[model samples]
Target: MRSVDADLIRQPASVLAAAISEGEVSSLEVTKAHLARITEVDERVHAFLQVTGEAALAAAELVDEKRRAGAKLGALAGVPIAVKDVLTMRGVPTTCGSKILEGWRPPYDSTVVARLRAADMVILGKTNMDEFAMGSSTEHSAYGPTHNPWDLTRIPGGSGGGSAASLAAFEAPLAIGTDTGGSIRQPAAVTGTVGVKPTYGGVSRYGLVALASSLDQAGPCARSVLDAALLHSVIAGHDPRDSTSINAPVPDVVGAANRGDVRGLRIGLVKELSGAGYQAGVLQRFNEAVELLQGLGAEVVEVSCPNFDYALGAYYLILPAEASSNLARFDGMRYGLRAGDDGSNSVEQVMSLSREAGFGAEVKRRIMLGTYALSSGYYDAYYGQAQKVRTLITRDFNAAFDKADVLISPTAPTTAFKIGEKVDDPLAMYLNDIATIPVNLAGNCAMSLPVGLAPADGLPVGLQIMAPPMADDRLYLVGSALESALTDKWGHLLIEEVPSL
Candidate 1:
């Protein structure tokens, strides 16, 4: 392989797209550089479930052809990206990190994937994730856990860990991930990347495999805030197919990112999202970031969202109920992982056998919990009450937003934990999303960007910024401002500090 332009793998997606468009470097070269990097490190990182080099090269070549012919290209044309396995891409195998759907190839592209293609971004392949998007750590994935690029022994964060890992590992400049109770933000927090969960339905959910229909939303993941904004602009819009999708003009996120000015903006620090359970070092970095934001002419004020305390409990109940219903379609009679196919066995027996052999422990636990919650005489007590808590959380956000333009918190309570540290302890694992779950519950948009390394472990720490629903541009304005200030201080991006894998 050519060593020249090998550095392309480390360039941000924004930079690569410009170079490719200006004819400084062909799309094929940039694509090859990233594919080679994936080949070199993915064995250890295990970020990719599949790598479609042949198809990726073909797409790149087409982009080059379009440019040479003076044809109009999409905004992100020629940039390579990774897709979370939960989104279906035409003919690409989407396993969602479970064995039940092992070899199933989706017949058509999901709305997000279709948008990526429309923008001329090359899809590298599907990424690994927690089985059925059910775990805080990627260890629940049937394929194996995605290791943290910062420290191999540590976790990369869950459900969307592979998407965050790919960016940190230099396997892809941009990737897509879904956030259902912090799947995208928590992973980005621990791995020192940028993740966005746009307001629920800001981006259509037509093709994303459902974890929780009410809470699931797909967004962008990248090494820098600007790149994430660019991807968000490309993929966000209403689709008639998704009844939940918001019908409105896409926000000017890219413009907000470029401005990077937070002067006179009202920044609220969520009182309920701090102290006690939070790691001291994480709090230290978050506080320091607040000071920096204040220094940038933004007013910092304390705001209370007391209902956030009940967000986790409510999220667990709501998500499992939806997941149980969504996963019921994957029985033995359908495609992928059919077991006990004997004439003597009844249809019920075959389904029981297939599900038993195919599901991972974590997936089974959620399914059972969901079934019990929805059972007769228990619906009102569990699922119904959880919905009431959800309403209360939204009301809390509404009251807080009345005082502040945007709210702030630590992205996660702690840095990346060891891979096996919390696998056996579900309750402990769930705590990692304490700060992020509230945004999902309220259907508001949020972004997680690296602030600095935690003093305790030298791992990355993230600052989460939240905006009211459809006010997503507020997140980019603040995130980009804070990001630029931190970079100036450190003289480099937080991801630049990652050690060689």
Candidate 2:
């Protein structure tokens, strides 16, 4: 690999795009640099399950040709990105980190992937993820866990760990992550990256393999707020194919990011998310962020969302119930993995055997929990009550929004933990999303950007900013403002501190 290529992988997507457009660099060179970076570091990180070097080069070449012809292009045209395997692409295999869909490649791209192509972004390949976006850490992947780039022994955070890790490892400049609970933000938090969870229905979910149809929203993961905003613009818009998609104009995220001024914003700190069970380092950094925001003329106030206390309980019931239903189609009768095909076995027996062999322990655990919760005797006691809790959570958010223009919190309770530290302890694992879950529960927009490093572990801490649904531009404005202030304070980007892979 060229030494110059080494520098290209480290540059942000926005800079690369400008360089490519201005003829200071070719798109093919940038794509090749990232692909080479992946080849150099991915085995140690296990961030990508697959890498499409040839296809990325071809796409980059097409963008270069267009630029030479003086054709108008999308703002992010010719940038390279890593896609979380949960979103389907026309020719690439999307495993969703489950054995059931081992080699299945969708014939058509998801709305997000289609838009990326329309914008001329090169797809490096699908990154690994937790099985069907199920786990808080990437340990649930059938292919094996994705290691943290900062410390390979620790996790990069989950469901979307591969997406986060790929960015941290400098394998890709931008990535896509789906947030159901805290999948996107938590991973970004632990990995020292930027993750955005757009308002529910803000980004189309038609082609995203659903974990919970009501909660899943796909958004961008990047090394900076502006880079994430650039990506958020490309992938987010109303899609007629998605019933849950919001039929509204996309927010002015790019403009908000560029403006990056929070002079008169009211930033609220969720009372329920603070204190107790949170690490000292995370809290220290969060408090510092609040002070910094205040210095920038943004007012910080404490707001209560009492119903948020019960969000964890409600999300578990809702996600598993939806997951059980969505995964039913992956039985022996369908297109994915098949098992127990002896002629003597009945169809029912074959179906049971196939699922038994295909699913991982965590996936099966959730399926059983969902089945029991939805059973005739327990439906009202469990699932019905969970829905009530979800409503209360949403109402709490509405009240909180009335108090302040945006909400703030530490993205996760702590920084990156060892890979196997909480894998066998499901409750401890579930607690990681406590700070981020309520946003998904309320179907609003939120973002996690690096605030500073924790003194205790010397790992990154993320500051989460939230806004009311459809007011997503607020998230970008606040996030970019805070990001700019933090970068200035530290005299460098947080990603600069990551250890060389």
Candidate 3:
């Protein structure tokens, strides 16, 4: 076994993979190092819902054995990674941080998880998330919220917060996250990690727990753009099992990430996503990043996505409406927790009671909101109207892309907020995704990379790069370039500045 340091844990997945491939460290050692990290800081970070130590060690041992036998391996082989709870892993507990499915172990692996296994990556564990992937801050999680590693009192962002937190905390080199209304990117933004929401169909949805079917996308979360591209290459491809999976070649994201050149690229700053509503420090860092891009010879321009203002309203309606339909399968009759099953109660009563007891306030709120929007009388007025707005948002992206190679914005209005500060304020909580929701509605590729820390809050601020749908490589190309420039200026990545637990 090779001795490992905090520096080993701090290295990005790409560096870890190279070390393992070069025989400087065995996969088992890497896995043990990460598992040790989970043991060390997870109590404070609460990033994981459960840690699959034995399974991870076994998987790492296999990678080591194969390496010793001189067998060819995937580029990310021997790296340990975390999976957001929304993705099913065979026999692993995947509650989505909701009590409705408490004690449930998935029977089979999701397409993404299967791909990770095939690549010989060690699955460290499942991370915590908002119940049913519903909230902007992870405080909606049934298992209690994952605290920001930067400031323990603050949130780690939502739905995919645990995945982002784990990477920021250095508990895992890479993680998988889902973006339905910015679950991946928003969390990445506040946590100072790199998160990419691949083009809607670029990654398979099969085996991912449905939140809003059309809006849901599984993507990569890592600490660096190149590391994200490495993980992206492993999980992205056509999956016959998923009807929405695009039957096309996965974009050369790894190559694009390596290129890291914005020279002659036209970068657009979205007019609607920046300015007044954004936090002063967040906007300041974002503007500075834009200046950095210009210094790198990228052409900068302002593009208006006028329809973006309505994205949040439309997304709330569409998301809840779809979530209501998707979550209907959790009735007491089949699986998961069942309540009011006493002989006196009817089956319908049992189902109703079970749902009432199982779901949290936030989940129930969305369910009811969705139910109302989808109700016969209101469908056309609410859900139907929201879809029209969705179309407009898509058009906005299309028009913006025509003017610029990529669109940019501050990933969120602000950095991580105190956990309970906005939990009681639903409107405020939802506002956290203001900049990120438009991309989901448009069904395009977008990424959030830490540009710097907000001086006021001393927390991470992310710059979002959105590319035209299916041109996912552009995100990596721009994100890597910005990441390099920022790193050079700061002398270290933003996450490195995190106060020690």
Candidate 4:
């Protein structure tokens, strides 16, 4: 057998899938190459919480056997992909980076996992995440933070940091992520990968562990726009099990990616998202992306979504209240961690003690804030009022969409910050998602793709493209255009600039 080239791991998933389907390489060889790559750099990246090498190899073998037997295969067959830890995979330890569920192995696969299996994608094990998907940086994880591959001292943007970092570090070609606020996009922004939050119900939520139920939506993460669209095509569509799932056809995402044309498309620039608080380097790259889009024949105009100003405030209150309700099931009597059960304490005492011991500071803080907001005395003032603001934000999106086919902004306020910089200050940490929160509130689709590296710090920067609800195709249309233009200017993908480990 020929030796697996080291550069094989660096190839995009689209290229790998084609190679596997055309008999250019065996599935096991591809899987082993990625596993070897993981071994080489994962210590510094810390992208995965667990590595399912045995299972991955076994799955890859099945794909090879199917090809030998002349059976038809899915588009992504034999591709190795990382799963966010928050999504359940039957019999796999599905820790959402919280000690409360540390050793728990769910008995069922999430809708997303089941889809991946059906598509014949090899599972590369679960990646790290913020505890209960609360923090903007992976530092809130109980296990420890995932370091950015670009700069070891900085954070890989959170909640889905592990997923994005895996792509940036070349540990995996494709990964899964959930966006409740900016978990998916923010991480992709900082890590210089591609992440998309499909229209709220365009993808099923049956298997994603709920963060803020209304805001949570699972999407694809990859190194390129086309790769993300391919994965998105496979995992999307209506599922009868999830009541909130939209009973509609999935968009032609792959087609849009292949189209990659922005001609005659009216792209809106969100006024409220780009001004003060944004870093200088971030703004510079963002302005360049706008010019690139305009050069591609995209008509750019400034549009205001004034209610976006309250999106952050409303998101905090709403997320906590829903999280408080969803997490109420983790009492000591359940399958997760149980503490103070010496038979000397009451059931309630054990439950309280278990929760106190299991949750991290950020989780505990949110739970408390949620509990308080939902209390009878404050319900009308806090939670109710926040819901009203949510309606206004949605209205703002509706109005903005009337004038533009898509909206663009810098995916985040700044490049990846040092790991410990904002961990201590909750308010500072919450501000990281400010630019991403409104899309969630409005139940729209959005994506973040690398624009260029920040000139000052030499870190990757991302540009966000948001589309109207169910018009997810528009995101791909613009994302692929800019991705191609930017790649031409840089002479290579931004990820190629990652320092050697």
Tens digit of lDDT per residue, candidate 2, span 96-146? 999998999888899999999999999999988999998989999999999
Quote model 1's TM-score: 0.99
Off by over 4 Å in 3: 1-3
Return the TM-score for each candidate structure. Answer: 0.99, 0.99, 0.99, 0.99
**What clash pairs does model 2 have?**
none
Q: Which sections of candidate 4 miss by over 4 Å?
A: 1-3
Candidate 3 TM-score over all chains jointly: 0.99
- Top candidate on lDDT is 4
lDDT of 3 by residue, 1-501 (tens): 134667788888998999999999898988888899899999999999999999999999999999999999999999999999999999989898889889899899999999999999999999999999999888999999998998999999988999999998889999999999999999999999999999999999999999999999999999999999999999999999999999999999999999999999999999999988899999999999999999999999999999999999999999999999999998978678999998999988998999999999999999999999999999999999999999999999889988999999999998898889988788988999999999999889999999888888788999999999889999999998988998899898888898877
- Candidate 1 contains a number of clashing pairs equal to 0
Model 2 TM-score relative to the real fold: 0.99
Q: Which of 2 and 3 is the better model by lDDT?
A: 3
Candidate 2 Cα errors over 4 Å, as ranges: none
Model 4: lDDT of residue 342: 96
